[model samples]
Target: MATGVMWSLCLLVCFLIGAARSESRALQKLDTGGGAENARAPPGPARALSAPSIAHDGRLVACSGKYLLGFEPNGSFAWIVPLGHMCNDSISPVFEGEQVYLVAEDKVIKVTPRNVHTAEPALEVFFSHNTTSGRSEEIIGLAISGSYSSLFLTIRNRGLFTFSLHGELQWSVGPALNLFDYHLGCKRNVSGCYFDSAPVLDQCEGALYISNTEGQLYSLYVDNRGIRWIQDLGSHGKVMTIAPGNSACLYIVFPRKSIVVGIDVSTGSISWTQNIGPISIEKNLPTVDSNGWMSIGSLDGTLYSISPDGDMRKFLAKTANDSVIHVGPILDCSGFSMYVAKTIVEGKLIQTVGDYTYVLAKKPSFILFTLLAPATGTVYWTGEYPGELSNLLSSSDLNDFTIDETVVLTLLSAAKTGISNTTQCYTRRQKIACICRQAKAKFVQADPGEPSYVLLLIFLLVVIVIQAVAILFCCIFWRKKRLQDNGLQKFLEKRRSLHSKRRILGKKILELEQRAAEDASSNEALGQLGEMVKVKEGVERKLYESYSLGRDEPSLEQQGSSLPLYHDKYRSHSFHSSQKESITIFNMLSDTSSSEDGTSSCSDDSESCSGTSSGEMELDESKSAEEAGPSNTANVEEGVQHELEKQHQHCSAP
Candidate 1:
């Protein structure tokens, strides 16, 4: 069971929205005045920390024991989300879509930055795993696909695991990973394969490249999942870091050997190798600018910029007594700035060219980041922070990365004054910044819904749809009106005739009922009364139907109905006068007369109707239906008289 913990993070609902695009990399100027020290870590009690990692949206995230803290680009506290005790050994979190995925111990947890208005819980345990042998596998690092839709997790002493965004395990390498035996086969002088960092994902080739501690380079295909290739470069100490090159090459840095090896991605072969001086930099990877040059600060006291092709030049070299880079030289997000992970250290005077400050323990060390021109090695901006950055994770793409023009001129002036990296003042702990507000490169948003045009387009489409619906309804009502026009008068006549027939049937039923009472045993009168009642019910039903057919028209007012009226008045009027008689004599005669000259031209009228269009046919059918329902006034009266005469004759004969 995983121990529960509560965490909180501020939700920027508009963070990825198009209207907020300009705001993403925009760093609001932070005020360092009012009780806050000019150079210090975020205000909190000292605790175990992790290296800061940058989110794509420019938010800075790092974990302190059970709490994960996010800072704005301007170094202001953004939010602190709680975590579980199982997530105590936390690595940097990765951002995908809107959720943050973090690996702690053997569990993968997802933290959603919920909007303040949302009541949903933010933190959830996505996955928990242990080796089949019951061995606890601590996850080392997490790598994401170039598309940011999938993830790959590397566990110490265990194999790699790839997962989809929805937490479905896509594939796994091994329950017990022996990279040395499987990939390297213990062929070279290497003894064991240890991975200390996440695999570098080559988005172009759709493959993953990783180097073990023993210099065993391995590549795995993303889409294929299982197939892999490896190359053994003997041993170059523990592989410090691996970065992508201009082409399909992997730059593997071995700090212990002070060597950077470029391996061809396709063949898994070494392309070139450049020797950097005695290397002390560990976690900081070289910054690859747009020009395809890699720049890194080494313990040799030189900032080395190497071309994509095998070439290296010292961007900045220190004299024998000059201080060296202590913490960073880590590049910024736009590939335009460099910042050392801010930390606290105690050292002697190093260099305070502008607002840059770096403190080291006891000895003197000048280590930080600089905005260097790839071609000229011009230092536009540089800064240092107070304290060790062991556990503090932050984004390299932090937005407050610019400095003022005067500060750049001051630092540049030192080159002419021959006093560069000379002016130094020792400080116990300090945070520093200079205004270098250069233009930020524009990034195309994934969800491109610009209010300037997309909103207008959406609105126009909505209006068109509404208008189309209105027109459709109008046409429907107009068609209904036409149908009513063809049948309205015929329906009215049919209704009156039905009423008259109903009256006649009522009188006949009363007479039969009276005769039945007078005889005391006349079943013939009773039977006739029953039949009359049934016919009366059917006539009343037909009358209700005629009114309903014309009910939709305003011409048909809401008259009080004597019975249940139904829709489709035209069809209702066609209902039989009785179950035994499908068509009444009165209705049949009216229909025959209305169609043609009695029955003589009925065939000609039907032939013309068959050739009519659907709209005309509908109207004709409605009219015929109405006429078929008690529309022949002469016929209806004569039929009633004939029925009464037949009844009287039968009674007189008996």
Candidate 2:
């Protein structure tokens, strides 16, 4: 009878194991593409823009034409304010502390953060000295210098002027009009010298540096109150921007030459000059951090981070051109956070923040969809029929789908189709259900969010009931055993041995169960890794095929093939390149071999260097270069067109 009971228990355990395995398999299969029936209607139509600047407190600030708009980190509008007047504004508005500063037609205006209604001019300064007694001078150029306390403005025809935060004039210097006469003499029919570019303020020396369209750079000593030094860059295009860091000056020129000239701040002597072609630099000025590394965008829609020593450590390509990235890239302490915005060919705005990027593309006439990160730059997630919105909604199904509340609200407000109302209702319901499920999961996973006194009372009651039952059973068993004393000592010993063996067996069974659980988890992780690899491989193959088909000229194809491949190998790869390079140097201090591969391999005992569980695989650099070799231009162009069509279809469907 005891043997039969054991066999029955073993059979039951086997049945349970089989059932669990079968259920897991069923779930895996169902996850492939089976959840479309419950999907909600598509979201509404709205135009998308990039929120590039984030305030110190994490508010996103952006410029849309002449308007300065502010939004929360989640893309909800905080406020919008228009500039006083628009005069072919090229640069994005700059913010310092609590005030926002803007420049237009040689006029400088400052406004307080509280005054964002309309275009309220708190203070304005004009600079144009070329006019006669009855005529108003055009402020040819304007720039803000120093901190918010000591503001400096420079104009083209006029010299330089300093003002306080309250708009009180501090001092005036220079009608430095003929400073670039020698440089401008190179070209016949040259107009008078103009200082259209903003002067960069040197906080350390309390001086200002301004350049002209004639390739002349001038340094003005604030204390000395005169020109320090002026250097002529021969026949170079207009000096677009200046970035001062590490006591060195970096100048960016436009049209054809994108030269990075480093100059000594104190002496105004050239330290090093590196000239990159026009395609290498965008109109947006490069941003420099506390470290010497500089990040600049290119006309070819790529972002490059160049080291102080002139090494290109990292580059991100395929960035759309939506808005001018005038504000330097933002860096967190971890070095893995930065943002960039680009305008697509369709006038859609796409912004990428940190490792995640979102593309807000236009759909048909009235609908817009914002494709989430990990979906961008790939055909599988982005190239499905009818586009990202329909694909995402259909795949997840409305029952478990999660929509960003701000996006949902914005879509609802902008909706024009009948599906808009239905989508709104479905999103609201899903959000409520998601909240409830999250709460329940939290309750089950850890201690319930209830009073400690209540939990203590329940625990005490359970313990009391258990003790009472055990005591009653002991009393009954002892009485019964006392009545039937047939070799009771031997029986007790035998029973004790059996219980010990059973306890040991139970412990072994538990150990096996734990091992099985771990194995199962590992298997699941491996499966996920495999899937990601396959997806990436497919995307890469497609990209290569497109490249192969798009080239018209062999030389151009060869040049394109020579371009570097940029992929983040880890989460920290998104950090500013400087920080990653610094960390690499720090790790290399202890190990000599680490510097060779640009990464420190971990030993078995070093927990800090443990391999990431996800195992993000990338194509070898050499392999990538080889695969990117020259292609036929006609084929490549056709391939690109096809890819675009595929992407369009993916983002547009229901």
Candidate 3:
């Protein structure tokens, strides 16, 4: 029987345990799934309208709406200025020294940086000139000389114009014969062309290579007015202009025919012509070193870096559709770095530097995000919107120390409150690795091991299992305890029945007591109010009697006085009266007795009468009560006393 009872208890416990488990599971599901949605980090800012361009000193500049501005790498706007309505072009502005040059519909204007480290303290217009004839000639290209002392401008239909840094016109040379006119048999190579590509000046030879829209390339003597040689690339797209380290050759792109051809500067003879597939070349090509190795892009959007021996290396690949239109010139600052501007769909700038790039997507939005790559196509660190960043002109001063300490610090701060708020979690880990990598790139450790990830998963599973087991045991124990107390359970059932009846009766009694207390409070308040009304009546009667007669008048005469006489007497009475005399008069009037009896009954009444008469003279010296009432003398006194009381209460309150 004992064994059977134990088994029965165990079974009952199991059943109860199962029920509790089911309920707990339901509660957990409701808590986790029904309460609220999971919170996610905000998205980064949108892209800028134009790609960021860098200045000589490494300051970044970009056109943001109608304003051109400079910003630090960490995305702080250093300076900004309005370009007015003249800012219509999508092309990034070019900068030199403290001035930036911009091209509009018909004019080219220069503006000072505004935030000059050393100040002559003026945003002087360095130059302004209109190059329009009725319809206005479009300014298609601009290139500053290596010294930045001379400007080379290309205007549609008007040819190339040379000017000094101060806008002085040096020469206006154009109307060159089209190569198509010369080569009648060669089919059209480029779709359309203007002198869009800037002239490449070879100082060693005193010669300039200028290509025109008619698929013609010209080699002109800088000192002499003569064309050295002309090559028909068969189509017009853009001429890839580059000065090779050999100093004797110039590389030009024949985009219409998808060819990259090299020409000898001395004789203008074709040194080498390499076919590089069908691609549209837009801006001037990017060259690494003086080795004649250059990277050029096609309209179809493939980027190729050609070797000195005319061999092509397909290093990076992106389609034209994936690329931005009217992208500024691709720049290769040194052998270690390459820069390109890509326009995002949202009309902001995305600057790719070497293997890393950042997308500056929106306004006041510090989505200055970064993308890093170790190899040709491998992406390294690629999350966290840093913040809004300006242009990056050069990577020369971006040392490991500066990058890790200052640059990283700035990025962390800019990201603290925006889309990057949660980035702090990752930054703490990344900062350690970044510092290690900065010390020695190869010293940087790899990510967490597979074993570590597995261990974390195991830890979570263990916790959940332990909690489930505890809950199951607890429910089992509770059910066993309930079953073991069967005899006591019967007694509890009987006690509960009696307790419930008592609870009902107790509730009814409490309701009746509450009603009785409310009635008693109402009666007490009414009684207090009735006493106040009786006191007011008594006081009024006394006032009437006092005002009816002078102090020296006989009681009989006072009693015989008319209502008008009483009112006049009240108006002429002394303003001040003794408290005792007033109280006695009030009692007498309330009793409706004789004034002699009232005065004789109170010893203080006689003294109060004499005191009141003396105080009357002093009262007359002050303004009348009517004037004092309007002046708020009573209200002022009450207000001061109330303020003091409030301060005392505040100080004393716990």
Instruction: Tell me model 3's lDDT, rounded to 2 decimals.
Output: 0.44
Task: Report the lDDT tens digits of candidate 2 across residue range 1-654.
Answer: 999999999999987787666544433322342323433422322123332444434454544344455545333445655555653344444556666666544456554655544466533433223455654345543445434365566555554667666677777765343444643221422445555556676553456777765666777776445677766664455545666544244434342454566666656666665654233233355655433456655443455565444555433343334322222333322121223332233344445464223435452222222221111221111122233434433433222223332223222222211231212222322332333343333434544335544767899999999999888866655554422464556545544433433343344334543553365223223222223222333334433332222322222211111122222332111112322321110111223344455434443355554334223324364454344323322333344346555756887998
User: What does candidate 3's lDDT look like per residue over 1-654, in tens digits?
Assistant: 999999999999987787666545433422232211212211222223344555554455655445555655444445655555455344546656667777654556676775444455424444445555564467666765544367777776667777788767777666354455563211354323356555666544556767676556667665444567776654334445444323355667654455677766667667787765344244434443323356554333345666545666653343333443222123222221233322323344445464333434343222222221112422222222232332221221121111211233223223331222222222222332332233222222334335555666899999999999888865654454323455446535544433433343344334533553365223223222223222323333433332222221223212111000012112222111333223211112225444554322223447765564454434443344344233343443344346555756898999
- Encode model 1's per-residue lDDT on 1-654: one tens digit a residue: 122222212133433353344333221112211212223323222234465656555555666555555655444556656675445433567776567788766678788765312688767887777566755457778877636468888876666778887888888763223554663423443334455467677654578876565556667888645446777765555455777654455677776566888877768778898887554454445666544567766544566777757788775554423445433344443343343222222432433333223323355443343455564566655444222321122322222223222212222222222223532321111101011011011112223234435766898999999999888876654454434665656656666667667878788767875795575334345434444554566666655543443234334222221111112321211113323332101111234344333222122236543343223334555355344334333444566868666766887995
Model 2's TM-score against the true structure: 0.39
List per-prediction Cα lDDT, in the order shown: 0.51, 0.43, 0.44
Candidate 1's error at 464, in angstroms? Answer: 43
Which of the two, 1 or 2, has more lDDT? 1
Which regions of candidate 1 deviate over 4 angstroms?
A: 1-45, 86-90, 115-117, 131-136, 146-148, 174-196, 226-228, 238-240, 318-320, 340-362, 365-369, 383-654
Instruction: Show model 2 residue runs off by greater than 4 Å.
Output: 1-53, 62-68, 81-84, 104-107, 115-148, 174-191, 247-255, 280-282, 300-302, 312-314, 317-337, 340-654
Tell me model 1's lDDT, rounded to 2 decimals: 0.51
TM-score of each: 0.47, 0.39, 0.40
lDDT, candidate 1, at 611: 48
